[model samples]
Every structure is written in structure tokens, then in C-alpha cells.
Target: MNPNMTPNLMAVLPTLIIMVTGMVVLIGDSCLKGWKSTKSLSAIVTLIGIAAAGFFALSRITEDSIIVFGGAVVIDSFSNGTALILLATAAFATLLAMTYLENKNLNLGEYYALVLFSTSGSMLMASANDLIVLFIAIEILSVALYVLAGFARTDEKSEESALKYFLLGAFAAGFLLYGIALIYGGTAGAAGNGGTTNLTLISEFLRHTNGVANPMLMAGIALLLVGLGFKAGLVPFHMWTPDVYEGAPTSVTAYMAAGAKIGAFAAIVRVFNAFIPISPYWLIALQVLAVLTMFGGNLLAIVQENVKRMLAYSSIAHAGYLLVGVCAMAGNPRAHDTALGAILFYLFGYMLVTMGSFGILIWLSKRGHDCTTMNDLKGLAKTDPTAAYTMLIFMLSLAGIPLTVGFFGKLQIFNASLMAGQVGIAISMAVASIISVYYYLKVVWTMCFQEPDGNTVEGRATSSFGVNVTVGLSAIGCVLFGILPQTLQFLINASNSIMRP
Candidate 1:
């Protein structure tokens, strides 16, 4: 089939593939007999579907951007880069969930199906070029995740987390939709034609018409921050993160951490990047939020006795770092590609660490018990030295210690900040990094030096090909990228490509 003859289909090929696969999975779960009854079948199907979609996305990386469906969704390098990250995260999460579900005896086929469905939504969000399209994509992802948050039907905390996520998420969605309405009203009045939600059209209106001076348009952008910032787990809007993370299954926690950030921030980058004339206004707000998020998240994490909650806070801090890169490009839309690329690279590294760390946490959990508190890790090095070593690496990476992906990722982001002459924020990052050390290292030191409390109960760490590979690869990736000088250049180039359209 000629691509030009069916541009809409071609542009949404991956999304369709993922959507169709989710339907197939739902069908399989409902109709399959004994042999297909195991949830593994569903997980396998989801993995295959996500893999196919990811391959399709990669193949289109060299193709020119195509805005289909009346310019609602645009396939471009920026979307592809973000889509690849979401796909990788889904793969790892699927693998983690397979074992997690089986062990907990909570292997509902709907779990994997929901993940695939949510992932497809994230993909759409990344490619969305219109406000209406973006809002729909956000709801698609959020609705599925709201259910998944409490997938463990018997757990009270799971139910609470799911409820909290849904309510807060709905509130955020209202803000986003209202922002879109305001923007549409402003544009319609200024452009003389009926209102439009398309980003490209909106940018044009701002540049070529009186839409720039429209108070409602600027107010709409501010409202957009409230909505997207909440989604990205920024401060004041971040209250839900720790509770939800600690309440949800570790596997789901891992998936949501990176996936949500990827989608929300992609929208943030696109908006700020395209609306260059409005940069000075939003940039100051983003910078202040970034600083608060950095210091606030790090400080809160420092006092957490629970590792899961600590990671929840850590996620917030990482979002702040990503925001810093955005602020670095505040005065220079030309730096959009480079700044976004740096954020993407850091996200990749962060994903690796989170997957491995939570994988270990999953392994430490036995049926009817969640392994999380810092005390539970005491004497882990004595019991399982290999696992201990892996944890050490992840901790070091999280702390931004040298010779790990996390280190280089921080270096690039900080370098971008300095280039933008945002020294105060850079210094805040440095201080936050130092303050973060005590907690990260505390985990390492506890694992290596503390003795097992006589009364402390522990689960036997299990081994399987899937778990081993996930953990090993993430740890290796952290170190491999750290020392590999060529990888950094490759990331820069890949990031540069995102703006080709």
C-alpha cells in the first residue's frame, strides 16, 4: 500500500496496532479455554503487540512528519522519541507484572490489556498536535491507570490509591479542558473563523493576529500548567504521588512513574517550544516551579522511612530536573531540541534504574507481604550479595554518583542550565543532589553494614530468567553509558533529530 494514499492509517499504524491488540487480549481473556486461561497468555500477547507497535514507530523515525485526522495527531521525530521510551517501559513493566501477578494470585487478564491500552494513549498524547486530541489522550491513559492502581481488589490501600488518583486526575482534567476552551474562545475571536484547538493554528494566531494580547489566551496557558504540572508530579500538585506509589503494586508504580512523566512533559515541551513569543512569561513560572519541585521533593524524600514513598518523592525531584532543562531553553527556542533531548536521555536512564530497583523490591515481596521499609533491607548484603550489589549500583545512579548513566544525565541537564545562565537553579540542583546523597547512601550503607534484626522477617529472593535479565541489563546500562563516550554524542544527535519536522 502506498503510504501517501493512506496517510491517516500510516500515521496511526502503531496506535491502531496497540489498540487492536488490546481488544484481542480482552477477547482472549473472555473466550479462551483452559490452555489459554493462564494470565501469561495475556501478558505475552500484550508484549508482542507493544513490540510490534514499537518496531513500527522506529521504522517511521526517518519518515517526514504527517499530520493526520485534520491535523489532530502529527507523527514526528519528537513523538517517536517519546513513544520509544514508553514502549520500552511497557515491555519491562509487562515482564515485571507477569511474575508479580502470578505470585500474588492476582493474575487478571485485564491487567495487561489495560496497560497496553494506557500505553497507546500515552503514544497518542506524544503525537497530539491539538488541544482536543491531547485531552482525549490524557483521559484514555488516566482512566485505565485509575483502574490499574487498585487492580489488587482485596487491598484497602490499593482501593484508596485508585480513588485518590481518579479524583485528583479528574480535577486536573477539568483544568486542562477549561484551558482549551479559553484558548479556543480567544483564538476564534482573534482569527475571525470558528475556534480551533490545533497547536499549529493556535501558534499561528498568536504570531500573526491579536491572539497574543488576548488575556484569556495567557490565562489558558497558566491553567495548562496547573493541569500538566499535576500530571508530571510537580510540587503542590505532587501530594498524590507518595500515597499512590506506596499504595499501588510495585510493578504498576514503576510503570506509572516514568510513563506519566514522559507523556505530560512531552506536551509541556511542545507547548513551550512552539509558543516562543510567550516564552518569557511561562518560563519564569516554570523556573520557580522547577526550583520548588527540586528542593521540596529532595527534602521530603530525606525523611522517608519507607523506600517506596522515598522513590515516590524521588520521582518528583527527577521531574524537577527535567523541568530545569525546559527552563534552560526559556529564552532560546532554538535550544528546544537539545534541551528536550537531554531530558529524554535522563528519562531513559531514570527508567532503567526504577525498573531494576522495583524489580528487586518485587522479588523481596512474598505473598501477603510488601517489602518496602528501610529496615527490611537490613543485612540484605549478607543474605544476597548479588542482589545487594545491584541495589548499590541503582542507589549510586539515583544519587548521581560518577560513572553511571544518572551521573552523565545530570551533567548534561546542569550544563544546559549553566548555558542558559540559570546558575541559581543549577546551584539548587547541586545542593539537592548533595542532600539526596545521605538517603541514597543510607540504603547502601544499611545493606552492607547493618546486621539482620533477630525478629525481622524476610522473604527469600527468587531467581528466574526474566527477573535476572531485567535487573542485570539495567545495572549494566547504568555503568555502560557512563563510561561510553560515544553514547553521549549519539543521544545528542538523536535528540537533535526530534525537531526535524
Candidate 2:
């Protein structure tokens, strides 16, 4: 085989496996229609596929980074580790969905298929080395999510959420494509052969030329940031996040919150790493956006009466924290590796915490009705002590309390910011974290101290083996990683070692 034509297939084995598994599930669902065991079988197959993909991804974490498919994709520790996070998230979401789907009369095989396909796209985004591949990967993920958002077609909010996400998502894609076009035109020499859409080549070109001075290249970079920042749920472009997150099913929201953010930030780090040599020109914009996102998300979350909306805003704030790591990556060359490692660590911790928090909501949801309002949690301790305590840990972690994974995740980012000499950003993060505590603890107090009204989810908590397992595992992981933050340090370190072509 031609070296460029075949390259190393092992590098992308995980992504291939995920994509194939999605097809199998989709087909199997259609063939097994009306079978009593079809629903359980779908969930089982989804878990097995995710486990296989995660195994491949974890193994790749220690392998040397290599570019494949003519440099359009790169198999590096960064991509591999991110792939693992995305896969693990999918697995957790699958587990949560098992009973939730059955409760909502949505135990369809297509649901599992969409989850698998979306996960594959997230993996591809992490590995994308070329602009074209990045765009395709994003679309693959977004299209599936748009459908998944409206999976509860009978519900008007679900349908509305899907429509809104699709519209905004389409516009974001346009911005990304336009940015790529401008970048390509700006880089192309008068002879028409020097321009490239490959990130590595773009970096080399910019390093050699005064790329920042070129109007087209500068505009493209700005637009590119706008496009991706929207996906990452940064401030000003985050109007869609709350509505969409609240309207989607709790199970989908859990997956979307973690899986989408991981993919977006992975792409952000890769794209910006290529632009790091010109960090001075772009760092200010990112810093401003980070400050806005943190404050905007936190302040807005404080007054939310609906639990889903509150958590939705919370997700936005977490994105701000992740952006701090991105800023640290660009602000100081010396802090690059540390910042990248911090980001991956933060993503892992946040995924566990977010999934667990949302899992609680799913557990409390009654048949055909979501238990997402603040009222539903009143006096949970008196009725369901196991659930109440699990939620307490989740709330504490989100507040960044001592000895929780959330606290350590923020600490690493804070330290990285200080290392990068971003004192203002560091302080901003601290203040924002403090502000977040009020809302998170309010949740804890509602469950533990308050009296339940006539109507509360605790009075009618749903029991599901799958949801219990998901929440239990998430809480344990949160506490474990918090006490032994160093346990995953080596993996984070390896994951940040992105290779340049």
C-alpha cells in the first residue's frame, strides 16, 4: 500500500469501531422490532461497543503520536485520551438511558445508534489535524445531537430545542466554513500553490510570514474563534445553551453536557496550539471572553428556579473554566504542557460530576414527566437518604468544595493561570467559583434542610438498577479522584503531549 494511502490504520481503530457499532445497532433495532428483549439488548450492545472503543483508546495513550490519512488526522496521546473521555461519557449515558428510555416510552435502538455515532464524531474531532476534517467531525456530531435533542418528538419543548439548536448550529458551521475559506485564500501564494488548510502547515506558514498583519488571515482566525466559542458555550454566544439543555431529556443533557464540551475544547486546544506562536495577537480576546463566560454563567444560574436550567448555566460556567486553561496555553509558552494537562484533568472530573448530578434528576423523574424544578428536591433527605447524600456530594463537588474532584480540577486550572502570569484571570476564576457556591449549596440545603411540600420528587422516586449504578459509580469516581488527584496525573501528562507535523 502507498504510505500516504494506507498510513497506520491502528491509529484510528477506535473511531472505526465506534462508527461500525452504530450501524450495527441501528440495523439490529430495525430487525428486532417488537421483540420483548430488544430494548435491553440495544443498551447491552451499546455498552459493549463503548467498552471496546475505550480499551483501544486507553491503549493508544502510551503510543508515540503519528499523523495518518495524509496528515488530515493525527493519532496522538491528546486525541487518544480525549477519545477515552468521550467514550466513557457515552457509556455512562447509555447506562443512564436504559431505564429512563423505558420510562419515557423511548426504548428504541436508534437512540443508542445516535449516541454511538455522536461519540465517534467527538473522537474524530479530537484527532482532526486538517480544517476540513475538523468541520466534518463537528457536523457529524452536531447533526446527531440535533436529532437526539428532539428525540421526544411528542414533547413541544423537545421539538423546539431541536429546531433552535439546528438553526444556531447551522450558522456556526457557516462561520467556521467561511473562516476556513478566508484562511485558505490568505495563505495561498500569488502562484496559487502555497496555501494549506492543514493546521500544521498553517502554523508553519504563519511562523514564516507576518500572518497577523494579513487582513484575510486575521479575519479568518477571528471568525474561527467565534465559530468554536459558540460550540464551547462561551459568553455572548451562549443564548442557546440554557434553552436547549433544559428542553432536552435529562439523559441526553447529561451526555451533551460532557461529551460536547470535551470535543469542543479538544478542538480548541489543537487549533490554538497551532496559533500559539502568535499568541500575543489573540490572547486578549480569549481572556475577555473567559471573564465574561464565568461571570455571566454563574450570576445567571443563581436565580434559576428550574434545576435543569440551573445546571445548564452551570455547564456554561464550566466552559469558562476550561477556557482559562486555553488562555494559559497561549499566554505563556512555559505553561503550555501544564495548562493542557490541567484541561484534560478538568474535563474528566467535570464529566463524572455532571453526569452524576443529571443522573439524579433522571432518577427522580416520574413516568412521562421530568423532575427538574427546585421544588422537586425539597426535603429529599427525609425520603430518600441514599439519593439525598449522593446529590449532596454532587452539589459539593460542583461548588468546588475541599476534597472533591471539582475543587482539584479548578485548583489545577488556577495554578496553570498563575504560572502563565494571568493573575487577573486567576482571581476572576476564584471569584466566579465563590459565586457559584451559593447556587450549588442552595441545592444541597433544599434537599437536606428544607421541609418537603405536598409535592416532591422524593415522595415518588423511581427505582432503576441502571440509574443507581450510574450515580453510584460517578460519586465514587468523584471522591476517589479528589483524594488521589495524582492517580490520573501520568495519563493527563501523556495526553497533553501533542505532536507537531
Candidate 3:
């Protein structure tokens, strides 16, 4: 609507490339209905598109922040950095899905298309400057995920996962929309223009007035947290995580774990950054949520026998740790840069670790069945040393073992929390990490020490080359970034510059 055509178009180039790629894949797949290589071709196309998008996003790292499309969207260091992470996530998911779909007899061209579409949505979420844009971005992400969850159409569990996610996801969207409406009403007179849903405008209004005293604004913020918290898989709203992660296909689970969290947390950080002025009213609520999510997720994961479900709970715990970084952003303007950089770095590291862990399951899966239980991994070290070692790396990283990216990421967050003077939260996070170590080590112990049962496949060879690549790349990322955190200095710089008031 705003006639800043060139800048606005350039601002959205990466997302545009992704959406176009999805359409191209869809059309190509439809036109090549009888070709045997259609599935592979779709994957190849999707990967190239993601790579191109990443290139464009990387090119924007040094550009000045630009609010485009009448402030509905923005292109900034934060968005550029987030886009790269999302693209990396989509690339890895595509690589894993290549062999995974073939093994499950679910190799459809639509799978890659949906992944591209969903990733485009995630990219938009990271840059969204308006509440309406954020909601649209979320739906674009959620709808594709619902379909991907049920891609294994014949699996009853897959269908149930899809149904539950869709129902719960719709309710979450409702909460988010209602929250936006209330904020719009509460701020109706603040800007002297009826109302505003633009984040920048909201900040401008709040800076001049007392947002905490406005009951409607406070209520809106609470509901908004509920909606975003549900998406981030925080405790009290994390009921769907274990069931959905267990029931979905392994490749889908990996993507859902990484991509969804990246997008949701990016939005959470950005939205809450806008609310920093009135943080006294909401910071306590977030702190409580962080502690609850950290302990609840770890304590529950300790009892899980199913590997996928355990990882699901582990993902929730990691969200709590990320929330600790979010808490650091409040009441301490000086700590904002450290906290934001830590959160971004942590998300990238977690993406690599989580996807690589699940990639092992995809690698071991037999045709038409997923290797899901802890017992399925028993004696894996003897049969597939490569996968076992790779899994070991992911487990150690998840447990925050030294020389892994997870440890450094956690360390940064720990320091950031302390910088904010949240000694209690810092201690709680340390205890939670200790609690998580047991379950992660349990995974490694089962893989290396336990005897193979009758259900364990004998002499299993790596089934998919794509999965091998995914696991290998993820392992390298985990260690490479860990040993040399400076490798991510560009992303850290981006995080440091974001959300400045």
C-alpha cells in the first residue's frame, strides 16, 4: 500500500524466493506426475531455493534496518539472522525427508512444497512488524505443519497428531487475535488515530504513558503470552508436545522441533522487546514460567522410556532456558545485547543438536516403521558405529557437556541471566541442566551398553544418504560452533543491534 516499491520488495526478497520455490516445486511435481524421480527433483529444487534464500539473507547482514510496506514488515539484522537459521533448518529437514519419506512410502512432491511454504512463513514471522502480519505468518506456518504431521496418511497416530495439533493450534490463534484486539482498543486514543496494532507505534505510545495501569493493555499482554507460550511449548501449555512429537513421522518431528521453535521464539523475543517499558508488570510472570518450564520439562523427561517423547520433553526444557535469556532482556537495558545474542546463538545450536538427534532415528528406520523406543537403540553402537557416535555427540551436547555448542550456548545464557541479577533463575537453570543430563546420558548408555533385543534389527546398514548428510553436518555444527563460538559473531552482532528503543 505504501509506494516504497523497490525497498519493500528487496526487504522481502528472501521470503519471496522461498514462496516462489514452493510454487515451482508444486507445479513441477503436478506436471511430472508419472516421473519416478519427481520426489527427488522436488527435494533438489527445494534445497536450491533455500540456499538461494540464505545467500540473499546473508547479503543483508550489514544493511541498515528498514521498515517497509507501511511498517507492516521490517528488514533488519535480527530478521536477516533469523532467516538464515530458518533456511538452515529447512535445508536440513529437506535432506532428512528425502530418504525418510521413501522409507515410509510417503514420498510425495507436496512434502517439499509444504516445507518451503512453512519456512517462508517462519521467515516472515521473524520480520513481522505488525500484529496482523504476525498472525498471518503463524497460520501459514501452522497449516502446513498440520498437513506434514499427517503425511503418513495411513498411520492412525499420525492422523491423531494432526487432529490434536490443528484443534489446539486454532485455539491458540484465537487467543492471539483476541489479545491483539484488546490491545488495539486499549491504545485507541494513545496515538490519536483510533488504534494501532503496529509494534513500533505501540512502543511509541507506551513510552509517553503508563501501559501498566491500563487494565486492557495488561490483559492483552497476558493473553498474548499464553498464545506465544503455547507455540514455544512452555509448560502448562506443553501437553501436545510429547504426543504430537511421538506420533508424527520422524523427519517431521525433527523439523517441527527446530523450525517451529525458532520462529516462535523469534517472535516472542521481538514482541516482548516491545513491551520492555512495562516489564515490571509482566517480568515476574515470565520468570515464573521460565522456572516452571525448566523444572517441569526436565523432571518429566527423566521418566520417559520412548526416545522421541523424551526428546520432546527435552525440547520443552530448552525453551525454558531460552526464556531465561528472554528474562534477561527486561529491566536491564545494558544486558539486552548479551541476552539477545545468547538467545539467538542458543536457538541455532539447539536446531543443529535436535535435528541431528532425530536424524539418527531416520537413519535407523526400516521401511514403513520408525525406530522410536529407547530399546530400539539398544546395541546400536555395535551395529552402526557411525550413527551411535553421532547420537553420542548430540546427547552430550544436549546435556550441556563441555566442547559442545550446547554448553557454550547455555553458558552464555547463564551469564546473561546473572548479568541481569537474576541469581535465583541462574541457579534454577543450572539445576535443570543437571536434571536433564541423566536422560540424555540414558540415551547414550542404552545405545552403547544394553543388549539388542529381538526387535532390534541385525546388521542394519545406513538406509538413506540424505540422512547421513544431515547427521554429519549437524555433528560438525555442534562441535565447530562449540570450539569456536566466534564463528557465529556475525549472528551475535545482528542480535546485539536488534530491538533498540
Clashing residue pairs in candidate 1 (N, C-alpha, C atoms within 3 angstroms): none
lDDT of 2 at 108: 81
Q: Which ten residues in a row have the lowest lDDT in candidate 2?
A: 492-501
* Residue lDDT tens for model 1, 352-466: 8999898888877777777888888898888778878899999999989999889988988888888777899889888988988888898898888999785233644445555
Better by TM-score, candidate 3 or 2: 3
Query: Is candidate 2 or 3 superior in lDDT?
Result: 3
TM per candidate comes to 0.95, 0.97, 0.97
Which one is best on TM-score?
3
Number of residue pairs clashing in candidate 2, backbone atoms closer than 3 angstroms, sequence gap of 3 or more or interchain: 0
lDDT of 3 by residue, 338-440 (tens): 9999999999999999989999888888875578888788888887787888899999999999999999999999999998999999999999999999999
lDDT of each: 0.82, 0.88, 0.90
lDDT of 3: 0.90
Point to the candidate with the largest lDDT.
3
lDDT of 2 by residue, 1-501 (tens): 666555467679999989988998888888755644544888888888889988888877888889888889999898989998899899989999988888888888899999999999989999999989999999999999999999998999999999999999999999999998888887786324867889988888777765354778878888999889888889989999999999898899999999999999999999988887677778999999999999999999999999999999999999999999999997555577788888999999999999999999988898967999989899998988888899999889988998899989999899989999999999999999999999999998999899988778754355688888889899999999999999997667765577331
**Per-residue error at 496 for model 3, in Å?**
2.0
Model 3: worst 10 consecutive residues (lDDT sum): 455-464
Question: Where does candidate 3 clash, by residue pair?
Answer: none
Off by over 4 Å in 3: 1-3, 33-39, 459-462
